[model samples]
Target chain A: MIKIKSIRNKILVWVFLLFLAIWGGISYATFYQSSHEVEELFDSELAQAAGVLSQFASVVDLSHPMIDPKLQKDIYGHRYEKKIAFQILGNNTLNLHSANAPTTIMSNTAGFSDQIINNNLWRVFRLNVKEQNQVIITAERYDVRNELIHEITKNSLYPLTLMIPILLFIIWVGIDRGLSPIRKLAKQIRQRSPEKLEPISVNFEIPNEITPLFSALNSLFGKLKAAFERERRFTSDASHELQTPLASIKTQAQVAIRSDNKDTQRHALEKVVEGIDRATHMVQQLLSLARLEPLTSLDETSDLNLYSLTQTVISELDAESHKKNIELSLDGEESIQIKGNQPAIEILISNLLSNAIRYSPEQGHVDVAIKKVSDRVQLSVSDSGPGIPEQDIKRVFERFYRGQNCQHILGSGLGLSITQRIAELHNATINLSHNPDNGLVVTVEFVAKN
Target chain B: MRILLVEDDPILGDGIKSGLLQDHYNVDWLTDGGQASQALQTDSYDLLLLDLNLPVKSGIDILKQIRKTGNALPVLILTARDATEDRIKGLDMGADDYLTKPFDLDELLARIRALLRRSKGRTTPTLTHGELELNPVEHTLSMSNKPVDLSPVEFQLLQLLLENRGRVFPKKQMEDNIYGWNKEVDSNAIEVHIHHLRKKLGNDLIRTIRGVGYVIDKQ
Candidate 1:
């Protein structure tokens, strides 16, 4: 349940990895290039200092009775900054000209090339004066190369350091601007009431990422609106259904009183009673359908003894069965236990049994059975009467759909539909099959609890 | 009493016209609200039993037209819409009483009588039928207008029978009306009550129809 509000967190995660990769590549490249450039600059500067000092050394006479002061001034003043130092080693005496005026920048050692000074760590280039039987070695402090490297690093790193905050600010603004539409959509939805089913109007310029979500929400609203409209229509139709019969009864009763003949009055009163019965039936069915609308399933969590529920429904139907002489019997598993809504299960069983009895011929037989098979609990009701036709099997589960032949029977045609709906709610399947023994068999099966 | 019934269904309208005729109430039945409304504009009626739904114009509209000119005649709404909302709507539209559809015939007649009695203010202290008369206010009985002594239950039973003369009041409705909602009466309580009432008022005053309830004819 981590709440992620900023899309930039995701963007930053990806961008930061890329940024690190590019920074690493650039840092390595610049480090390589600057170090190479420092080496080249040091080599050239060493060569130039050697060439200038050689020219000055060739003009010097160590055995001269008088060394010209001007020549000494010229040699000493040849050095602008004491980055380069000169030393001449010959015959157990060393002549050294240092940047510190008699102090060498590095201890010199040479044998036909250049060497590093161990004590002072300077760059030293050696030139052998073989004819003079002497070696002239020039040295410079390492500060000249170190200073150049430091300057290059400072120039390269300054802009990179300043860019970190600017990059963060850009990411922040980009994320906020990117998520603005989602925020607007949330506000619009929050302001709406549950009854409002209007589609959400969002910008076409919205990122492809959010378009599918908006369309899905719009379609969901459409379905919600349709369901509400259907419910409202059902209520209105129910009222209309109940109102017609009541009007008939009242009008008939009032009419019956005006007739002077006793026989005519008796007939009128009988008709009025019939109208009342019709009205009562419609009201009961309407209420039952209303209750069934929102119910998804019968409570199927509780352990239910199917035997008890069947026995209760059968007992209730006993009076009718006796009156109709439609021999009703319950058989099969004696103590069948299952998980289901007891009342819903009872209602489904009752409707089946009642319909079987009502539509069955006088003295017909209704066989009800509850049996447990592997991984399934099955309840079957078979009647020795005219079974449903093959084509009408699916239609039987629709509301208010009485078979063409069964119109003579007094029923709202909701009994079987409610049964099917209840079955669907419980994740049970209802199969209507024509019995080979000349009747209908309705089988309801629920998956056996493991 | 004369009654005007406005309804749309021909089968029901004919049935009601005949039922009222048998009850000795002169009923002029109109199947259309427009005809009924026109008829009422010209004539007068003691009571109007109206159905909410009708052809041409609704019963409510007819009632509105009738009431517009200051007519306060008693109106009883007899319709099948039993929802509390519909009942309230019918009553608020100037109906004196409301009865849902599929109501017992005896119950309808009783409501009509109650409405008419209230509207006319016909307060006869002793309500009479045949030779039996019961004084509701004084709780007394009179045979031929002469005072007669009777037990309290017998007196109440005689009063109910006389009040609904010539109509067979079913035992169930009588048991419910006579006894309170919570009172526990025997299964044959109405028969027992009728037995005692008949003994005091004389058996002929309370007639029993087989398979039906009791009735006191207005001979």
Candidate 2:
């Protein structure tokens, strides 16, 4: 059900999907890497600023009862650029310094401590301040680093958001333009009537991938043209061949009507009747051949009992063979089942049998046999009569081709042609040869399904 | 026997007219489709021989018009188109028989006779008068149920006679029903076959109208 008509559309769809996956992956990786990097830089800068301010703690003059405005200015100045703050803890009493530090200081007896204050995340480092036995806790606000990362990420994502609609638009337009030639070809095919079998002449400058499609279509059209020509030629030739005998019959009948004498009139009319019979026979054969031309494939999978079909064909021709004193026998194994189109196989066998019966001399024997090999079923018809010449054997399968020596025989020469076509349709082959004593032998072999 | 011949070609029309005249069938022929349609509307011909392909109107159209008016006239289609679809179409359009073109004159005459015999409702009911009896359903004829042995052809002949027992049936109609539509019968085959039937059924059953044809006159 998946027609391989449009290769470009498939390639474009895959390409667009791959682009989407890769773009998403790269954006996520860069965003995660930059955010982690900003967090690490913020941590290291806070620790270094706390170290620089600890050296200035020796000048604080802690024995003073009240806080010094000079010390506050000194600490605030040192930590101004890095947005750092600190708390000085002495005997469970706390003194906080810096612009944004809360009035209540954190209890930090350990080396370093980090916590959130007033709904703001803070990273605080605890210093011992060994001279006073007081804990020096230093902290920095976290929103500054986060704000920088957010700005950088927002700038990077703006172009990607804008590209989604543009990418989809390009894919749609590319697929439509790529398949335009296919639509043109479909329209060209639809414009043709059944009687017209001309090849498609519309050509476009396209990619290398499209050449195979064009060539495939060209070859199919070529075959269709040839088949139409063959059928038209066959019909006209058959009409010409049949017209002669019909014209003769009409002329003879008119002549009989004009004649006054009874004997002459009766003789002319009798000749006319014979001509009419021959014409009718020829016309029937021609029509059957025409019908066979359009049937290219076989209904080989049907539940066709070949034995019954063979019996029917034999019975149809039984009366003719009885008058000729030729015995038509069906020799085959019971339940010789093979899968093939029944009607074609019947026509194949009938033509061979009729040829055998027609060419055989009076009282000569015709043997029809069927056998099943390991993987194939073989049906053979051998006649005891004058055989086909060695040179003309190949030519007999061609349309309207008859052997030179068999010119005296009553045949239109389409029988073997139709039989060969049927054999080709079934993927079977006809093996023809001359019988050793005097006659011809033709065999059709069918491939077994199992 | 009178037949309405509906054909297109002038030469074939003239030839068939003369040919039917020789066989003692009074032929009123029309060469155009319009004329043929008009003739069927007014005339009481024993049979209608129609060609499938014609100018101004097709044979199928004409046949459809005939059947639409509930006219039970027997129409035989004679055409060059022998495809299965065309035959099915003609028969579906209420044609009694289909004969392809370039056919034998004898065969054509025989088919026309067959259609005429069938048109008279010869096969629809059992015909009985006095000691003579014929059963259309069983296709058997008997004199007082004595089991008269007859060939298939002779049985059909007796049935044709018994169906039209009260009328003078023509010789051509008898040959058509008995010999089929394709067999080439000479002019005398009908006469000879009727003679044979008379011999078997007793000579008093059939009467020969001189210079015309044999007839099964009604008792």
Candidate 3:
């Protein structure tokens, strides 16, 4: 199932093929030059042999009946040596000939010529010795010169043929040694467990080419470790928050069961119901916060009217505001549009509005506005309540961080956290500030779609 | 026994206070750290039930401050943090006990009882002076195996004096121990409670040191 093209295999194949091509070219050139030099050397030897024969004719008595020269075997010559024959000619007569020499002249008046003698092609070199008034013709078979060139060519190619396999082996080993770091890195990764998100150690030496890869992998591990730690902390805090409410409910129910008087029992039952309601609200908020945390993509978004969304949230929270006798109103641009997920945006606005209403004092006023400012749509909710303290303003977006001034309020402290998460999902920015008049003002700015 | 319950969660604090009241323990509950710190400095309590998380000041800081003042008040930490490190930190900071939230009502009561017993330098849950035995859990008193009925105030007064048999308790201290901060006590409240205890348990069982206070001689 592994479909990777290995770097080691690629390197081995390419380098071997290149080495073969270069070696083949050098061998061919060596064979060709040796063949050419051998041919020229044998040709020159033929010419010099003709001149020596002419001098031998002068020393011998040519006027006496021309005696046929006996064939002689040279003890120092190789077994495949070609026969060299020469004839001395005076007044158009064959004066001397070896045992294998042709009776007919090989070539007439030639410096060097090719001819057939005794059904074999010969390389004939003729010299006219004017001092002795004789012509010397020295001839060697063409097959003999060709055999010499072939032997030289074969000898020159022998070393290259032996060196090719050794060169291939060396190339393979060199490539493997060069690419060992990558293999080691792959093995190191394969040996790790899924839960082991610790950074890979850089203790051993590595090549410069693969150092960046290691650094990137280590950084990725660091990020994954941090993400897991955050998740763990969130789960622990959530369970802790849930346990408190459940403890309250259990204690209240116990109180109800232990009471002998009806009034005390009824009061205890009321508290149990209240505890359940608070726990349910906290659970719902926790679920909303969990859902909002992973909404990183905006694929399910559409053009939403901020003004209408603000009005809908305000209307939904009207009863809550009325219970506290707080005045709630929505105003500003009528139809400012931004692209966002409707439910996410609704949650974002509802959290802000509910938080404002929950913290606002009796008879306090809450104002909501949606306005188009430049290229953005700004949705702001201002409440007349005690705002967060200066030190706590930065941590309001953290889950379950209730402000010092508003701890008595019935809240799970996840409202602003959820709001911040949803805003980030829709590529929006949220800001919390103290209202100059009183209370806190929360503003969410979304980039305009159009 | 008088107990100071410092918790930030209103409903849980109320539930614990009501539960403790049903057992006839004088409980003064404070919802924030600032007031709880102030109360601990100005008032006296047999034991302290401290919650680690609070609004203005954290419970740990109050515990630290209490310890810093060299007050060896028995502190039971009631927290939603069940981590081992948090427990260790609380105990290392001079807390006498640690309890995580969603705790059993019986367990909380037993821990409070144990803390009170430990603070009074007693190993048993029942207080005894000679033949009179006061069982706090069962809310019963017996002299030589015969049951005796006493009102809640008389029972608390007898339990306090019997727990510290050799030591004398000033009248004001006894009154504060029997009543919470919000309860308004008449000037003769302690005297009436002491008279009722003497009537139920016998005159020699309760002693009045005139200018000092009341004390039961160790048997």
Candidate 4:
């Protein structure tokens, strides 16, 4: 699996890029609007200046004679005023001009136009003075107008340039503060020991964004604690149950050694063997219970015939039931095939059958049947034994819980638990009920495969 | 001394019974809690050795019932549960002592002897009456400081009578103490053992009251 990038870094990078894009767009719009407004303002000023010059020219006397144009200068004129020059054109001749004016008509047009005078580009606005029968042209260089536009844009953008670093710093701090709860939670989890399964408490108030995360983690801790508690109880109970048989074996061995009579010694020795067998059975059952405890998936798959499987388990237990004079029989649909884990299904069948045979009275009957009911394959095992009490039926599936009625019987009490676990693995259901006459009927139903 | 041993496991119960018998104490072994409870209600025993996990009824329930009836029987709980909480519960429920399973037989015998001694209102394991002295632990009988040999049954009979001096024991009770449930006894088995004990310990040591039973005088 690829390592995921940190949420904090991702948020920071994306937000910063989005802010930079928005700021750039706004700055471009502001520059575009102000530059257009400045160009229009400068054009109006040139028109007004041309109109005033035409009025001044119409007022001046030109009937005497045409003379060479003299240098016109204003003592109070600004430095850029030198770049603005005008001329009066009468009948395609230069009549009057400023100091920077060329000795030629700038434009023949009667409105604003561009002209190259003395190899320099100029913006000339011409006006018609009808009383004088002449046109007055006001011209300014292209470089001067460009220079003024640049100044306006620079002054307008100065604040935004300075605000960029400050905005980024504020965002970085805000993200850090917002993510502090998650960091604290991580630190608390990292410092915890495996044995300590307590729920973590964030010392600071959790932000809304990560509250669900914290709650989920706490719930997981709760489940883990419960699982650990269950494991501990199982280990303790298993040891205690094993200790009894071990004690019996030890005490019986002592009895054998202390006995002087041959018959007594032999009896003690036989008891020792019985004790060993009981302990071995308990250990085997404990191992089976442990194996089924973990929720591991069953890997083995095959088509299992319930009727045949029941028959095989019954045959294996034939001698045991025979010793007690109990009759075992199987009656059901032949070749009832179901898809399942073969060994797990076999174990499930074996436990139910053996339990029935073990709990039945002498000469009692144990009947097993399998059938297809609706969308399910149903298997039922009923035995003519003293049924469990009403209160103990629910507790029978718990590990090491023996019914009060069946205390005389030898059992590790793990059979039903294992059976239930296998049923769960197969997505099946098992139900137990007291027989109407005097026994228990266990029904296991598996979903039928098409 | 007679002990009522209520244990569910057959092998362990049988082994304990055999060991107690070897020590010259009468033991009536029972494997069912209900049956043991019935015995406790109907009969008299010196000490009760009860196992916690039993059939039909649990050992703790039986002990509680016994105590509720004002039966101050010294009970020693024998079980495989060694948890501290279990031990405390057993003791708090009026058990005189608690012994975990897989226990040493020697330790069990020692605890039994102590309980028996405490019940009889005595501290020593040795019983003495006039010139006769008996060491219950060593299973020895001596008269006037000289060792005497006695059969196992005769020794057990003499020990019972000596332990409960001045208390009359009928023939049936005496026979029950001397023989186990499986043992077959002749009609005159108790009389024959009494005869052998009188001959060895002297006739005056045991006084047989007419139509009652035998008792050893405290004097």
Q: TM-scores of all models?
A: 0.53, 0.48, 0.88, 0.77
Q: Is candidate 2 or candidate 3 better by lDDT?
A: 3
What TM-score number comes out for model 2?
A: 0.48
Query: Could you report the DockQ of all the candidates, in the order they appear?
Result: 0.19, 0.02, 0.65, 0.51
Model 2 lDDT tens row, A1-450: 555455665666677788789778867876898899876776676666556666655556554435554566565444334456667666556654665566687535454555778888777777776766666677776676667777777778778868876887788787788778878878877876648768777867745666688778778888888877887766655754565466446745875776586975786677677676766767666776777777867645565555667778888888778878887788887577767677677877788888888888777778878888898877888888789878888788877666756644556678898888878887788998777876898888877655
Model 4: how far residue B73 lies from native, Å: 5.2
Instruction: Find the 10 residues in a row with the least total lDDT in model 2 chain A.
Output: A73-82
Clashing pairs in 3: none
CAPRI quality band, candidate 3: medium
lDDT string for model 3 (A106-145, tens) is 8885788888877899878888877667888878787777
Residue A147 of candidate 1: its Cα lDDT?
69
Q: For residues A203-310, could you state the per-residue lDDT of candidate 1 as single tens digits?
A: 646788988988888898888888888776556656656566665676576666656667776877888788877777766766666687688655446878887788
The digit string of per-residue lDDT tens for model 1 on B124-215 reads: 54566655566554557778878887755566566666666777877765665455333578999778878876676676777888887888
The parts of candidate 4 lying over 4 Å away from their true place are A1-4, A49-111, A115-121, A126-139, A161-230, A288-311, A327-349, A363-384, A420-450, B32-48, B55-75, B91-97, B110-137, B140-219
Best by DockQ: 3
The parts of candidate 2 lying over 4 Å away from their true place are A1-24, A48-99, A107-112, A132-137, A160-218, A241-268, A283-393, A399-410, A418-450, B1-219
Q: How far is B189's C-alpha from truth in model 3 (Å)? A: 1.6
What digit string (tens of lDDT, one per residue) describes model 3 on residues B1-219? 899999888789889998999999999999999999999999988899999988778888998999999999999998897788888989999999988888888889988888888888789888766678789889999988889988998888888888888899999899889997778889999998888777777788767898989998887
Is model 4 an incorrect, acceptable, medium or high docking prediction?
Answer: medium
Write down the TM-score of model 1's second chain. Answer: 0.58
iRMS (Å) per candidate: 6.4, 10.4, 0.9, 1.5
lDDT by residue (tens digit), candidate 4, A392-438: 99899998888877755778888898999999989999999877777
What's the number of clashes in each of the models?
Answer: 22, 0, 0, 0
